[model samples]
Target: MQADIQLLLTADGSHTVRHETLGVTYHSIHGAVQESQRVFIELGLQAAFERFANVPLRVFEMGFGTGLNALLTAREAERHGRPVAYTGVEAYPLPPEESQKLNFDVALGTTFLNALHASPWHETVNISPFFTLNKQQTSLQNWQTNERFHLVYYDAFAPSAQPELWEPEIFQRLACFLLPGGLLTTYCSKSYVQRNLRAAGFTVEKHPGPARKREVLRAISPPIL
Candidate 1:
């Protein structure tokens, strides 16, 4: 483990990494697995699947910390026999040595996770027939892409960890990356966060959060003016 990182066992027996320097964990300490399954997969991916059945869905994730969200999404795509093209942007990717210590593969009973971690950054890898992943190692502020997505998993650390990410300019860029009516879900439901999304032209809603959290936000993109 890196000197600045510590692995913590969450309430659900899952491992989460705490960045001692950044003062944040990769996932909620309540239960890393449950948080991903609820916020990203169930709320974001599953809901999008309902409206985009039989279509190859495009998903963009802001932070690909442990690859947990991507792994769960791949399973969901296979379970429903749908296809998903996932793009995850991480300014600072977790080291392979540390990510290897995570037990999500065994916990989820999946083998492709190893492949996800091995796949080189900045290239799209076909991890499964139903799932394609593109991991970009660049900050959202500096990253550029013309592709749009149907759903976005805003899994970045809390505003306290990286306040710049929660600003209005970032939300405006995210809004432009989505097709009209597309969904963006995150574990954050802070009032100012909602205001930023609204300022960026999203119709925001608060939904019941998973353990240790009260609410989450799911925002819909409106046509760009």
Candidate 2:
């Protein structure tokens, strides 16, 4: 059964969702927008642009959740007039009723958010001239794609919640789909997680995190020699 979701107002007045059964929140309770901006936008996206600005950027996300990360990415794409192809894979797609109620629009604009939710799955839809989205209603484990990505917004549930997803084999699978020198950012900075990333052949860096957390992890795939 799908876990019931409840809308939550975070410290920054942005909305996140809480899983009624699992007791997990979609984003940080301290401040949702800041966390996404700091980790995904500022760190992940910007870094990708600096290195690979010659071509349209490709992004893959583990959890589509509330479309917060995708919406933010679209906004950046429009601002810079750079093309972005984003793929969000979700095992349990959020119901439209709940996803539509999120307040990310107030801060990041809703045009893309609305389109992101309404867009059909398994099809490439242009949410904006510069941003195209492919929403897949499936888990990463079962997802098959030969498309290589430049950045990965790994926003899955915490390791404590889904231990299987944090293993070395999973990281190896993610690394396989990423282009050489591609970046992967995740909110979890656990020591063992970093070790798993290294075991999967990624070079990991610990970055400062947002409220209630000290650090995050940004892992880079080995560059071609």
lDDT of each: 0.91, 0.90
**Per-residue lDDT tens digits of candidate 2, residues 26-131?**
8999999999988898889989988797799999999898899999999998888889999999988888788878889887655777888899999999999999
As for candidate 2, its clashing pairs are none
Clashing pairs in 1: none
Q: Report the error of model 1 at residue 193, Å.
A: 0.1
Residue 128, candidate 2: Cα error in Å is: 0.4
Model 1 regions more than 4 Å off:
1-3, 223-225
Every candidate's CA RMSD: 1.4, 1.2
